[model samples]
Target: MQTTCACHPLTMENRASAAIIVRLTGEYRVPHDLILTILTVMLGATALVAICHRLGLSSIVGYLATGLLLGPYLLGILHESETIHWLAELGVVLLMFTIGLEFSLPRLLASRQLVLGLGGAQVATVTLLFGAALAVAFGIDWSLAIILGGAFAMSSTAVSLKQLGEQNELATTHGRVSTAILLFQDLAAVPFLVLLPLLGEQAGGIGHVLLFTLMKAAVVFVLLAWTGRSLLPRVLHWVAESHSLELFMLTVLAMALTAASVSMLAGLSATLGAFMAGMMLGETHFRHQIEADIRPFRDLMLGIFFISIGMQLDPAVLYQQLIPILLVIISLTLIKGLVMWLLIRGFGYQKSIAARSAIVLAQGGEFGLLLVSQVISIRSDEAGLLQPVLAGLIISMLLAPLLLRNNETLANFLMHSGDKDDAKNAIDNGAQGDDDFRDHVVILGYGRLGRGIARVLIENNIETLAIDSDPRLVRELRLQGEPVLFGDASNPGLLQQARIDQARAAAITFDDFEHARRVIAQIRRFNEQLPVMLSHPADHDDCEIGDDNVIVFDSEMESALMFARQLLVVAGVETSAADLAVNSVRSHDYSELRGVGDED
Candidate 1:
């Protein structure tokens, strides 16, 4: 395959001159090295994720591991490609997008106590405590100490949320507390992002610069919010009316890229813009479909971001700075965990919930890496220490899932040793009444299609626990006393939370191909005998990897068949003849479903 790729393939000129020929034609768009790097990363990451899945590890670890192996310190397959660097930026944007999709004003208001009360305390207390320690211990400049301290105050939103989600603990009081804290950190990080660069700007008065930036950000945000309220839906409606999945996807990409560009031009991070775009659109009914379409892109880009982060870990440096790295890791986990726990306890949470949330949020988050890198860029003298600090951060994140997996045991060992665990206040992190939900159908993606399927099941007196990520939908349904929960249905953690073990069947109506694959894979793991109704979108190609493997409901094909069947009857053909004709077409399509294209 490689030889074919390198040989005289798909070009008028010989392989030796094909690249040159393309360059001569003023179409030297992408470099061959960039192409090779992308292919290498994809293949390596996929294989590693497959292995990790079998070993019950998160795919985030797999992507990071792939980066470490291919990094400059290892095989050197990916040599810090600039293209990959920028693409990694897109990963951050997508992360913000996912967060925005799940964030809504009502939910924010609902968690106001935690966000404003506990969240505000965690940041303020952690920052002051850590910053003071740094200043006193190392005699670093007070300003830089505060900067690094605030940066370190951040907990990993991606890691913590995913960890909580995987353990089926995300719906618990502790999980909500953790999520609320993370959300505050996300908001806090925005100010830090604006402040980081300004700290390096020695010319202007620092306070004045900060004020100016804040004012500009406010104006830009208000403009975008107002525009989104009036303009975005109309654009989406027009594109949606086209009935072309491709166009709909293109429209989404355009919106994200355009908003990101405008934000960058307006002096804010593209990621902040992306998040704003998502939050603005999140309130609309189109959110589920938007999330489904954006999910695949988001996942791939997020993987790439993790890989880029992994690439930053230099093994040689890690070996040389092992002692300091260990010290940093231990301090970060212990201090941050203690601070978080105390804050939660002060807020009237149970000891169990507080301790567990502390452990979960103790690690250095993905955003910390961003801050570390940013500070180092603004202060080159700190470069040497930042590298090892980053290495420690990565290690902590990789260990997060394992820590969360055994959190209950860990929490028990920490407190109330000789007592029978209090079932009332003790958060049920796993196996919460699965036996009670037996024989119920699990509907992934509680959107239009999933809801319709659920309504039908309900009509027949079947129970359903609809899992979704849209905050608005989840909030409304729960208030109306419906059995729906907000979570990423593709995640096994969410599935377990929905009590997959007791589920009799499932309807995978998610419109995104990637998420659908995840949902199907997770279902097969829990119960191979359980029936799955997967949705094949209007955009299935023969060469797509998952198409042949899973039996899915093809909406486009079924709709076409329905239209044709009724048309035949209207044209005077017998009902049975039309039915036979439709069945024959269906059979023929099914036979070729797994087949390669004619040329292949």
Candidate 2:
């Protein structure tokens, strides 16, 4: 029996390229150099990221470090190439697409105030202030300064949202404020990007170029939006019917890339096109599935993108201009943060909210790097300032995760505020008169279980306060006059505002055992005697809480008990007897039902 070889037969092009490949003793012609390059990057990324993970840092830090170590600056193994650049850019496009999924047109319109008002104010003021400073300090042309300023005004949407989300603070006031400003910044980056090339190519007639670009952008947006609204649903429905995962993935990629290409061809940012595509698909029923399917691609690509960013930094240049880079980083993080705080405070937000928002958005953004790169390409004379600014921005991005992780602490320290009560106060504005809700239930994790509990409690004329980390849910409930506040329930300040100490009982309705435990721990910290009830799946081993006042409700077990009770009643057993049996099982904490359906 003959075995088939998987090696590609060497043709003319292969022979030409073969000179670049190291010969190995195998019929299978593997590109050893390419494999080795990929292996080196992967191994470096894995080792550094693992260390970062162990040290409780973001993986992005590790990716950047990997690039720095392997890039031309240090090891000389990897040099910047267009292939890598294009691939890295694709990563950003996918990222923007995913973000657009979360911000549908309706949601965008709903948040017009933040997206337009606070967001508009933030972009305009930061641009003007930074532009004026650069003009005075560097004595650069006003147009160049303004271009650089627009870039500086942008905070990293990818960095801020991901870091804030991991901390479970996305629903907090600062998180909301940061998100709003970032949304507008993403929108604001498009025009700047369009103008960058025009400005670089020529010094005059920029207004005409910008106006033309905007018209093209508007046309492309409308076409994409219309396609997404009408054609996309049917196309996706057909894809789903085919029941092919590969096909589905390909289709999603096609949509994203096609949209991006169209925008790029039209002289607009590719990310804007991909983002719009995502927003369009977000309206379809397949949004969740699409998001889930695209996540792995987004994450991997985004890692590559960050690594490429790291590769761009020149260590020699960095060392030569250390002081200036340091100053730029400080101004970008500290002075920029101050500006944001003042701006947000002017919007009538609490000091804590304002301060935290400032910290969250202090760093320079990816768009800023894009602008700086353009300026460098056009004005090599300004490399002295531009290079340092670029380096400074990357360093600030590296620090962003650490800053966001401790945003609350930093906000408190910077504002000279003692507690998070102010944050709670700011979020609890909707619950104004409900502060007097004594002897009421405080429900955490207002999903199905929490809402069910609230309905029953309200039906019985008992006041109840519900805390959920879902901003949309909180908004909806608030509009309906429900005493719901958007926040992480585990925060002591939020719990305090919920009057946890004064409540008759507290319920932790989260399905995750660890998450529920955290809320319980926080509640115990404040009100040691408050009767706490937590929900968990039936298969979980018996909880070992030391507090006797705490109760555990196993959802699966409760359902089984109800089913058994109904079966008994249907079998002609007395209603009282069925109730007694169920009550007896409940009294013993369902010990007999534990591990009843084990597969082993």
Candidate 3:
């Protein structure tokens, strides 16, 4: 008698398809199911993310939505599988690794007042308050409540930072505060990650379990630290000497996975190991390169992880627990915002700064989603609260961008700072002081080029002021007696503070053409006839400004003209002739050379 195969029909069909594709592809067998799945995921993700981009929403929303639509509860094209699960976890590991890479003791020390003082207080207090509320109200285990609280205390770093950056607020007081708090939150998540699995593995005897986990972790850390200090640098140095990007990338991947495996063998979470590995590597000079190489892998894995999260939301559960989810969302935003404002205010910040910073952080974070998902995975029986909590976290993230966009306005209104113009003037005055600058050259982007221009202007007794986005750079420049302000040049308020209206001319030295364009546009709004100079790459798209007063300094074209002039003079042509030829080329705006490579 023939034995019956125990495989499902779908599995058999997938196997059959794979077999046919293997035959068609050639000697190197490739499974069709894998290809199909990848294609479906890519297509879905791209379409959804594109829509979100167009709608001015975060890409995270699209990713979660993609998972929801394709998940088992909906279209059922993607289902829970061991392979997907492992892949999702890998994404989490990589993400933790990157976060760890960003950890710098010196940077933390530099901003200790905000980073350690305010940030530490925010995390500790918020976590305790949320934990206490959850435990008392829901009657859950204190361990689970603490985990949930830690999760809730996290504000989306990606959302707040990006929104503030787009609004040109990163150099603002509130922005600095928000950044510090977010940094502490990211750091705080690591311990929670280490604790979660330990809590799940041993249900009761909390103190014993905590002691045991800490002991094991300490041992692992000692071993890894000693080994990593000696081993990782040598391994990485040898890999780098090979001059093979592919090989180097493979080595880095191996290092991360190997560290993770070691942690797993030690009965600790793999992400903890990865984070440790990243921290070790971060001390080395190769940190930036390693970060760049690992980003694509991290991003892909993260997308899968989020998709897996989306799959966990059962439609029936979402519908049944809609009210609870809404309540959670409301609490995550409004109540959390109030708590944050109080915390910031208590730290001696002004009401406006406190309110703005609080509003910026009033939402669930990606890390929160990660923690909630991990909880759901470990505690299957806790679905009632877990599902609604997870759903609420996702929805709150969806609304984060909207909240962040209007943070300043809301802060002003709530804090009763002033009307729009009054608030604007207040900020302008705070940023600029009472210095009256007139008929001076306003330089945007105080990088290499901007510094050079400022030096020349100063030498010629032409008054100049520079604007740069980097706070550290701005501070350094200020110490050297450079009239530089730390703020986004694209911001009209910042431009106005730079005295763009009274400036004789404005120069945009930013390499990014788009940013330069925005700066130029803002400058025009203040002084339409101000002779504006834009520094850009020769290959960049032509500016649409069409204003004769706006001058384009194409680096490539300038270099070519200099080369031609020198060559002509060297090749027996008169100096006057060479100058004339160069001037002719310049007069046509390098149209002669620009036309030569137009095909590309």
- lDDT order, best first, reads 3, 2, 1
Name the weakest run of 10 consecutive residues (lDDT summed) in model 3. Answer: 425-434
CA error at residue 94 for candidate 3, angstroms:
0.9
Q: What's the true lDDT of residue 271 in model 3?
A: 82
Instruction: Report how far off residue 130 is in candidate 1 (Å).
Output: 2.0
The global C-alpha lDDT for each of the candidates, from Candidate 1 onward, is 0.76, 0.81, 0.82
What does the lDDT come to for candidate 3? 0.82
- The regions of model 2 sitting more than 4 angstroms off are 1-29, 135-143, 241-244, 374-382, 417-574, 577-600
lDDT of 1 by residue, 1-600 (tens): 354454444655566586787678786465887779778888999999999878766787788899899998899998766777788889888777767776788867865887877898998898888788877977777666777788678888877777776676776777778887998888777666666657665544767877887887888789889888899877876766665667877887788778778788887778777878888877665565677667778888878888887887788878899987897788678878888888899999878888888888888887787777667657878767677777887788777777878777787788765344543455545443322375899888888888889889999999998887665666677678777765567656456656787788888777787767767777777777777777774444631534333457788668778999999999999999999988997887745433445355
The positional error of residue 18 in candidate 3, measured at the CA in angstroms, is 21
Q: Of the candidates shown, which would achieve the greatest lDDT relative to the real structure?
A: 3
Lowest lDDT sum, 10 consecutive residues, model 1, at 427-436
RMSD of each: 10.3, 9.2, 10.9
Distance from true location, Cα of 123 in model 1, Å: 2.4
The prediction achieving the highest TM-score against the true structure is: 1
Worst 10 residues of 2 by lDDT: 426-435
Q: Is candidate 1 or candidate 2 better by TM-score?
A: 1
- List model 3 lDDT by residue over 388-444, tens digit each: 988998889899888888887788888776756534432423332223576899898
